[model samples]
Target: MKRLMFYCQHILGIGHLIRSTEIVRGLTNDFQVCFINGGEIVKGFEIPDKIELVNLPAIKTDTEFRELQVPTGFQTIDEVLEYRRDQLLTAFNRIQPDVLMIELFPFGRRRFSAELLPLLDRAKAHGTKIVCSLRDIVVTKQDQVRHEEKVCKLINRYFDLLLIHGDPAFIPLEASFSRTQDLNCNVHYTGYVVQQGVGIREQKIGNGKQAASTHLPTPLILTSVGGGRFGHDLLKCVAEASKVLETKIPHHIQLFTGPFAPDEVFEQLQTIAQHRHNLTVDRYTPNLLAYMQQADLSISMAGYNTTMNVLTTGVRSMLLPFTGNDDQEQTIRSQRLEQLGVVTLIRPSDLHPEAFADRIIECLQTSPTSMQFDLGGVKKTANLIRAIVHKQPVIV
Candidate 1:
């Protein structure tokens, strides 16, 4: 079997890690996969047993993306950088993968250039086919022209293929990166990579109808913050909103604060939930989609993976995009989804509990119009990689 080494670094959110693991799951049947995770591990995040897992010196950033923090070990930033760089090079030398797949390097995660640039050069020297796995939207920098130019230069020099995990009909690369015409590598859109078979409702064979799900007796309102590194205010507001709606609306509220939520934040949410019988709060769940599949309404921050789950499940959703560090990726995505008439956008100004309860009620009462997207990203990505590794015709 052809060996493929996949590298992913998620500094702030778990969306990147979730999406990368989903893509790697599809490639295991065709390729011997070595999955490289450079972020702090989220407990209970599943990886395929067939793949070799490499956990590098885990590092992450604050919510503002200001500086890197060594979450567990006592090593300083400089030591971690040097050790991580050497570790990546040594892994590349040992595995000698036929294809090197990187997630969001030139488009995002620019701070890791110290290690990534060297690894790219070494892979180029070894004649290993290089692929870039990117999401639909990219973060905008201050100097737009200089940023795009640098990205184009690096992509053209090192990359063999750029697989964008989104549909062009919805949003293309040029929407964010204007200079798509500049890159020399082969680019393909693989639609949106979604968690397989989790959020979808099953069908019954005899009645030709959807089977009954494990839904709660009352109306279910599900809210989550991706990774829990940020978005404390959102969850807290949701808890307060539940109290406001306690007597007005007959609904059960469930909150998934994510694995990285601070201990104090989780405890506070639990305390708030203690007073309300209709409200419950938890830290993490491996099967979030299953709950989303059965939910009457979904409320959460607009991250790539969660949005994909909403799209996949066709659930009624309200999204409050994270605007930290002037990041526009989530807002851009949320706006498009709203335009499609499937989701409602929540502004920061609308976080008041009494007012937000009305917003939640409005969403629960209105059914979302069904829309279709190219959600076959995982299978298509596997096919593209197989073709690239075997020198077969590139077909998507």
Candidate 2:
């Protein structure tokens, strides 16, 4: 069996780790897979026993992009780089994988470029097939251009293939990368890799269900605001919407304030939801897809993973994307999906609780459009990696 090393980082939310887990799950049956994750957050994932996980000593970043201080007395970037380099080299030496699958950072993750570049050099010298996996959409035009240039330069020098997890019809490469023709020879669109299996199919009777069983109301609504880094507005909107619709609608609302939400913000949300028996506040659910699967109407921000999850679960959702950061990729993607009639898009500026609640009521009354897209390509992604390792041509 070919050995594969999968590398990814989880900063804000667990989306990267979640998607990487799905990819690893697809590959583990046929390949000797080892995961190299940077942060301590990897422990939260429900990975298979066969997979090897190595958690490197990496600092987590706050919403403002400041790196959290490590216990080590050293404070300089070089010190961090040296530590990471040693960890990466040691792991690579131990595993000696045939293929290295890097998630993001071909064009970005500049901080780790010091270590990653040397590792790439070593991998190429050893003839390991290097695959750079990218999500459907990149964030901004300038960043995307810079990323494209970096990919072209490094891919030509060292990398073997570019695997994009989106259909070309929905989002063509040329739109994001100006020099798409130059990299066309090595590019492959592997379609969307959604989370799968028995976990998604079965609904566990946890706190969510137990609470619902106790005091039930009409048309259950589930809303999530991703990592809560930029969710203060979303929470305020939900609260306003609940108050406005308290007398108008007879439904109960389930709001998930993400794991990263501050304690003070969560307390405020609790206070707002206290009196209304129809409103429920939950913090950090692992199985968010399960709730989305059962919800009559869903409200959420249009983060990449959240949008894909909503699409995969076929939830009738109203998306409110976070603005003010360089994170408008969600809005761009959500708008496209809305054009395809998959979900509804609501801008943060246009959010009114009364209007949002009315829209929710309308969506709940209507039938959800059939999800006609085939998501089996997630497995195909693993197959492509296997073929690359064996020096066989990929069918797609």
Candidate 3:
């Protein structure tokens, strides 16, 4: 098998890492994969056993994207960046991969151009095929025209193919990015990449239609905030909402306040849950799909990975898109999904305990309409790479 080196960085949230890993997992059978992760590792996040995962000196940013933070051992951002740059170059030289796959480079994560531009130059010199693994929606910048121009230049010069992990019928890349005509690389839509084994599991109950079970069992409410760094308000509101609904509804609420949640926030949630018998708080879980599969109502942010999971499990969901920093990726996706009748949109004004609790009750009573999405991104990604390696044409 040809060796493929994959680079992924998660600055504030784990959505990017999770999506990239799912894609990497699907490529293991076809390629000898070397995964390079450039962010702090979450404790329980599973790394695929079949691939070589290189964890560089971790660096992250604040939720506002203002400052770069280095871990305890590092003194400054410069130190961490220098070490990471050296480590990445070393790994690429050692792996000598036939393909170098990078996630969200030109489209986002522009801060890492210090290291990535060098890596791209090295790959170009070595005659390696470069690929950009991108999500459906990209974050819009203030200087939109300049940003598009830079992205097109970088992509045309370095990347041989651009694999968009979305369905065109749902929302094409052009919705956010208008410079597709300017990019010279081969671009293809691989549908939406979902976690493996999405629908194979047996469904225990209907998809969020039945109310609090009047029988011997209680209903389940599942909530998660991706990475937990920026979702404290959402989780806290859900915790308080659980208290408000405790008397009116017979249900158990399980909150996964992601792995990166601050210690104080986690402790606060624990304290809140201590008095509420119907609520529980945890840091992280490797099996979120299992929870979604069993949940009658799934409440969380409208991130890429979580939304895909909700859609695949056919679970009733309330999506509160992260609106910080004027980021509209999640909002755009959530609005479209809501329009499709698969999810309920939670606005910023609905964060109050009483209001949120009422919304939960309303969502639980209504079933999400079953809709078809192209969930075949994994297989198609692998096939596309294989065809590219073999110099064959694939109908995109």
Candidate 4:
């Protein structure tokens, strides 16, 4: 059997792990997949029984720069680098996999490049097929040429394949990466990777029937803003919006404050939600799909992985995208889908309590239906990985 090594590091939220889990689930049958994760986000995933996991020293990011903090109490950058280097070298020597897949390297996770460069060198020396997986977006054109030049160097030197988890027809790669066609032979568009679970058939909602009605409400409105590290504005906006719409539109609001939120904020939300018969506030829920299934509408930020999950469930959604750190990517994506009549985009600046409530009400009024794309990409990605392992040509 072909052996594959998958590497991913998630700092802000569990989006990277979520996407990686989809890929691992798809490849489990034909490959002996090993996962190397080094962050708090790793604990969030329900990894498959067949896959083996190796936990590395966890690292956290600072607000100013992508500084690495060792979980076992390291004070200096050199100490962290030396420790990670030793760990990676040992892991690579032991695994000796046929392929090595690095998630978000050469584009997003540049901080980890200190350890990754040496690992990539070792993989290349050992004849491992090196792959770099990217989500649909990267940093904006803040320093356009400089960013492109750096990425171009990495693409030319290290990666054998650039696996993009998006359809270019919807949002082209060139929109983010300059001179993308220069690396054409190595690039592959492997559609969106969505979350999966038992008894969850593709495109089927609420087990193919409406959920049982209760005294509380029928059509629920589920809302989340990733890990709640940066959702204070969003949560406040939603809370105020719910108050405005209480009398006009009767629906229960399930607000997920995310895991990283402050205890005080969560407590306050809980208290506010307690008085409102139509509102419920809680921390993260692992079974988000269950709520999405029963939800008449979803109000959420247009994070890359979150949007994909929302689209997969075919729920009428209103997206509130973050304005900083090249988050315009989400805005672009949500707008494109909005043109397709799949979702509605609500910019952060334009968001108010009343406006948000109005948008939610509008989405709830629409009929839920199937999206246009064939979501067989998970299986397709599995097949492609298998073929690559066996030295067979992939037809794009």
Candidate 5:
């Protein structure tokens, strides 16, 4: 079996890590995978036993994206950087992977170049085919032209394939990266990479008819703030909204305050949640998809993975995109999904409990329907990699 070394760095949210895990899970049956995680470990996330896991000293950024912190302990930033760089370089030399797969490099996470530059140099010397895995839309930099130039330079110098994990018909990559014309490597779209659970839901949702309800079980509402770093406001709003909704909807609210939430914020939410017997607050869960599958409605931020879950499960959802650091990626995604009638968008100004409650009422009243997306991402990605490994021509 060929060896695959995959590197992923997640700073603010676990979307990158979660998406990469699903992809790696699909790959373990075919490859000897070495997974390098460059961010804080999300404790409950499950990775396959066949994949070798390397956890680096955890690093994360604030919501503003201006400050980087070593959340795991007292190590200095430079100290951890040197440690991770050495470890990463050593892993590449030791693994000598048949394929080098990197998540969000030149397109984003440019902050880790201290090590990535050196690792890329080593991989090139060994003639390992390097692939870049990117999400659909990218955060736009203020000096975008200069940023695009830098990205083009890196791709031209190091990468063999640019695998965009999205469908062009839904939202083309060029929608965000205006300089796509300049990159020199081969680019392919493997469709939207959704959770594995969602692919199977299509059949179940197809054959099962909605049960008529004279006495419906209390509707289960699932709410999550992806990564829990910046979603204190959203959680607070939902808490307040729950009080307003109690008399009318009488639903059960399961609030997940992502693992990274500050203690003070989580405590505050816990205290407020005491007001409602129908509400429960937790740090994280290994089985979010299970909750989503059973939920009547989902209230959350518009992170890629969670949004895909919402789409896959056909749950009525209300989305508030994180716009901190002038990041418009989530907002753009939310808008497209809203236009496609996939989700309802929540404006920042309307995030108050009262206004949020109003939106929840709307979502609850709407009928649940799943849209068909190109969910062929994992299967297609595996095929493309195999073709590349065997020097077979690939067409997306």
Candidate 6:
């Protein structure tokens, strides 16, 4: 089997890492895979047991994405970068992978260029096939034209193919990266990579983590913040909204405060939720998709992964995109889906406790129309990679 080395660094939320995990899991049956995780360690987030996972000294950034910090005090940012760089290059030398799959490089994770740039050099030196695993919409930078120009330069120099995990008719690479016309690598769209849906009963429910019980409520409202670093406002709104909507809707609100949420914030939400029998709040659970499967409605940020869940599970949704750090990727995605009648978009201002409660009531009164989305991303990605490796003609 051809060896594949995958690299991903998630600074704020687990969405990127979660999406990467799905893709890597699909590839494990075919490739000798090595996954390099370059983020603050998530204690319970599980990866497949078979792949060789190299967890580098974990690094994370502030909610603003302005400052990079080491979770462990063993090294300064400069020292940690050097150590991670050496670790990555050493792994590269040992594997001499036939394929190097990078999650969101050039398009994002530009901050890790200290090590990533050199890692690319090593891969090229070894004649490895380089792939960029990107999401549907990219987070555009301030100098977008210049930003995209540099990205094109990097792609032309090293990458063999770019797998855009989205339907171009909905949102193309050109939506964010203005210089898509200038990039030299082959770009293929592999549809939306949705998390697989499984029956909640089939799961083992380990770690004292409660599954979305069959007995919870008549109509469950699932609310989640993808990574938890910046969702306090959303969660707080939902917690309060549940109280407001209790008498009106009589539905249960299940809130996931996210694993990275501030301890105080999580505690505060828990305290507020405990008084109401209709509201439940927790830190994290691996069975988010299963909950989405059972939910009557979902209220969360419009991140790629969560949106895919709404689309796949056919759940009515009210989306409030994360606007921190001036990132418009989620907003762009939510708008497109809203236009297609897949979800109702919520503004930051609309997140006021009463307004959110009213919006939830509105959503409960209405049902979302299911729109046909390209949900073949995971399978198509595997096929595309396989065809490229074997030099076989295939349609994307």
- Compared with the true structure, what per-residue lDDT tens digits does model 5 show for residues 255-286? 88999899998888788777776677778876
Q: Which pairs in model 5 have colliding backbones?
A: none
Model 3 Cα lDDT, one tens digit per residue, 69-95: 877788877777777888989999999
Question: Whose lDDT is greatest here?
Answer: 1
Q: Which ranges in model 6 have alpha carbons more than 4 Å from their true place?
A: 201-215
lDDT of each: 0.89, 0.73, 0.88, 0.75, 0.84, 0.86
Encode model 6's per-residue lDDT on 110-178: one tens digit a residue. 878899999999898988989999998888788877888888899999999999999988888788877
What does candidate 2 score in Cα RMSD to the true structure? 3.1
Task: Please tell me which model should have the higher TM-score, number 3 or number 6.
Answer: 6
For each candidate, what TM-score against the reference?
Answer: 0.94, 0.89, 0.94, 0.89, 0.92, 0.95
Question: Which ranges of candidate 3 are over 4 A from the true structure?
Answer: 198-217
Clashes of each: 0, 0, 0, 0, 0, 0
Model 4, residue 247: distance off in Å is 2.4
Clashing pairs in 3: none
Which one wins by lDDT: 3 or 5? 3
Deviating ranges (above 4 Å) for candidate 1: 71-75, 199-215
The candidate, 2 or 3, that scores higher on TM-score is 3
Question: What TM-score would you give candidate 1 relative to the actual structure?
Answer: 0.94
Distance from true location, Cα of 159 in model 5, Å: 0.3
